[model samples]
Target chain A: MNSPLITRFIFLFVFLSLINAQDKNGYFSLENRLKFGNFLFCKGDYIRAIDEYNFVLTKQNNDTLKFKIALAYQKLERYDESENSFKELFTSQQFGSEAKFEYFKTLYLSDKFETMHKRIADDSFIESSISDKLKRLYNLKHLYSSKSIEDSSKFFQPFNQNESIELLKFYVRKQNLDNKSPALAAVLSAIIPGLGKVYTENYGDGITAFLLTGVLTFLAIDNFNADHNFRGWLFTTLAAYFYAGNIYGSAASAVLFNANVRMNFDSDLTLFLNKNNHFSSNSNLFCK
Target chain B: MKKYIYILILFFCSVSFSNDELARQYEYADKLFNDQNYFEAITEFKRLSFFDEKNVYAYESNYKIGIAYKYGGFYDNSVFYLSHAIRTTENIDERIQAEFQIVRCNILRKTTDRALQLLSQMEKDSVYSNHQNEIHYWKGWSYMISDRWDSAAESFANISDDHELKILSEQVSNDKYSVTFARVISYILPGAGQFYTGNYLSGLMSLAWNVLWGYLTINSFIENRAFDGVAIGSLLWLRFYRGNIQNAEKLAVQKNIEIANTALLYLMENYRGEKP
Candidate 1:
């Protein structure tokens, strides 16, 4: 009720009036838009930030903005756009080497391994400034699909001793891997009951197969000795059917085991490489 | 001094007018929501929340966006935005409403424990004393969705005895089969459990298979054919016996599930009750 209260009210009124046109974060100006776009980007709102960046691009051709746009594309999994952006930076003196690495990275991450190898070979033929480490990585990627890589020694030369040793073990494991041939399994089973299952490393099934066929054969012989011709013929037919089924099942099991081995090797190698960041992109100029 | 008073009146009127405009936009967004255009409504509501400087539309917009998301089956997004609205709203009533919607989303997401915890918290709040019935209602709904018919019935029983949901829950609990009983009966007598569940055809077929295999095993042994006896006994008779018991237990459980489903379907289609 006093003059001080009136003075305080006036002060509040003036402050409120001054902020009338401003938003919660203040005026929606150009600089404010850029700040908001970054704020959204940090909040994982890539789609909205892309909209703001698109607007900003209309205003200037800033190198930082271009890099940010490309990074956004990469994060959103628009690999084609990101690759194009990175490729454009390949001729820039400051970002040339870094862009070249990221360009190949895009090809690799997009599962264009064959195309990436071709590009690597073409670049190497031109004496490109690709690093030895990346060359080794590309060589391994090529070896992944190569049927001629029976010896892993030639591939490990570009790597260090520790990596070469690891690669050597991996190569030996892949080469010396036991593969049960289905035809061999089936043939062995036909020769000796349950022998095919044993050949396929299924010892329990092999023993069961031997016991079952042996029991049915004993039943047939016993029935035949008793002059029960019908029962003897029935037992003989059942034993033959079971023997044939076991041979077929053994072949199928062998095929399945080989498939499992190949699948395990592929997934394990992919996971190991991923854990080591062996295929991660590098854009030294932009990322810095 | 008189001029200053008139200027103040004008400023106050303009501020109120802006608020009215914001309310109109909110109505338009709500219309979109009511029309089942949830995706579009979400964008409109987001715009209202983003541009309203007074922040009056923050609670309404965010909460409606959460509801729209729930209707569109974006459960995780619904919960996130609903929780966000609860924090934005200073009004205790609006806060409770948002929390209730979040509990419903949790129910749909099959996270009943979280829904129950949130419901208990809201129920205990003195600010939500008037909202206790609605809270209990959703608690029952959460239990029902989780397939805990007994717990759900108990919750609805806390309300009036003649409540529609109470009757529905009671029916569901009554219709559910005793799984242990089914397994025990099947263990004692193969195919008897399937018979108990009214699967007569399956029960008879299982019984016939067991009897046939048992006769073959015993007959072979009586004929002094040890090899035939052992083979039929171990491989065929024992396998059919095990299969019969398994089939009995499975049929009983399957029947109980069908019973519970019928009650649930009745509640969904015909019962005039408040739902989550």
Candidate 2:
């Protein structure tokens, strides 16, 4: 009887120890997974971090984890998923305003300036704390979009004095872009062998065209004077080919020059926005 | 007697749950790595490193992470993690393994100088003196990737006279056209460079065009039309001459590419050996 009792007690004690071990190392427990997910998030491994965070979501709802998942989606450049995730937090007491700000930012980053502008203008869910900053972002978005902007006074009101001065240069460059006209370039080259290329700022090509056409025309005249009819006609034909090709080339060069100017202005505007933190006071809002 | 029996029973029961958390984590990470889920595997390995407070899994974790990065095409990151493994491991074999992995990564990254530098350093170290064959092997790879066929041949010849890579390198060195020679010969004779590079048709066309234009230019000057001579000489004769030189240089480069490509294709298909 005593032996059986001792055996029963030992089995119970061993079972309790196993339970304790499980408790100590619940590797996939919600708390442990959350901790691991946070580690991955901090390390910029957003994809796997989202996996771990979503794993925890299967067990329970957590606002902080949801916000992190949205931020991770944003970092991964999955704009649709990021927008949807942020939309889910729009009514949350803690992250509602922050979600609104980040959602608009995602819209801007995704190049949906029209949508961002419309949402900022019409959405009643805007928070007072971020209202000025959002409006400033709205003004900045105008620089990137093809949409016409408001007057300089209204636009400058959103930025500080120093920023206004710098942005004014970009704004003026945007307004006074030296876009060449292809038709004008063609006519100029037709009137003068290479003037259209000169108008398009291709000085070397212009000079070459002028020299080649001038030399070929002189050869045609010289051959004709010497009674070399075949040679004269050959030079005339070559000169005609070069002259017509130059006219067409000048037109094409004008179009390319305009494209280059637009590209440079867009790039400069983008760089300025990036260098100035996109004129956002809350650039680091949710990142911290 | 009952007390001793009770103790034995408890010991047996406890032993069933003896695997700790860190060990289980290590096994899980190893499973991920073996399954080739490197993106997730890196995370799991990092998790193990984080929880392993006593640094027990430092060497293994870094090594696995480095290998994972290598497979992922992140050679710089692979070198970084392998360097960590080298620092943490006390074993000479493990150190050599990590160091060679760094060399392999550098080779694949096309940083041949760093790879050669590290390999030579290892060759000078007494601990790696016995690994000269392996060093020479990777050195050959570095030279091969840098397109230094002669150096590659010499490096692989250090391993054995009949080494396959050595043979391939030597074949490439002999069969490839010399760009400078082609250019100089074309400068001397209108299409000789093209003939040397085996572009017979281009060579003949170049020679014909140059001769026709040259005769026209000289005849114009002989006929007392100075302007005609200058126009023909500058516009047609010189253009063909310059084109011949350019074509020769281009053909030589293309021929060498074809030769190197043949060797590369053979290596890819039939060479039964490790590659970078």
Taking the true A–B contacts (Cα pairs closer than 8 Å), what share appears in each candidate?
A: 0.05, 0.22
Q: Candidate 2: which stretches are off by over 4 Å?
A: A1-24, A146-150, A281-288, B1-19
Model 1 TM: 0.74
DockQ of 1: 0.19
Tell me how many clashing residue pairs each candidate has.
Answer: 0, 0
| Candidate 2 per-residue lDDT over residues A72-163, each given as its tens digit | 99889999999999999999998888888888888888988778868877758678877777778877877776545658788888688988
Query: Which digits, one per residue and each the tens of the lDDT, describe model 1 over residues A1-288?
Result: 579867766675655554553443332445645665665566555666666677777887655566666667777788999889877876766666666776676676677787776776775422246666557666567545635465455577667897776666557666656788999999988888899999888999998998898888888898899997866886798798889999898899899888887788768777877775663444333222
> What is the TM-score (0 to 1) of chain A in model 1?
0.72
lDDT of each: 0.75, 0.86
Which run of 10 residues does model 2 chain A get worst, by summed lDDT?
A: A279-288
How accurate locally is residue A117 in candidate 2, as Cα lDDT from 0 to 100?
Answer: 65
Candidate 2, chain B, TM-score (2 decimals): 0.88
For residue B98, model 1's alpha carbon misses the true position, in angstroms, by 3.6
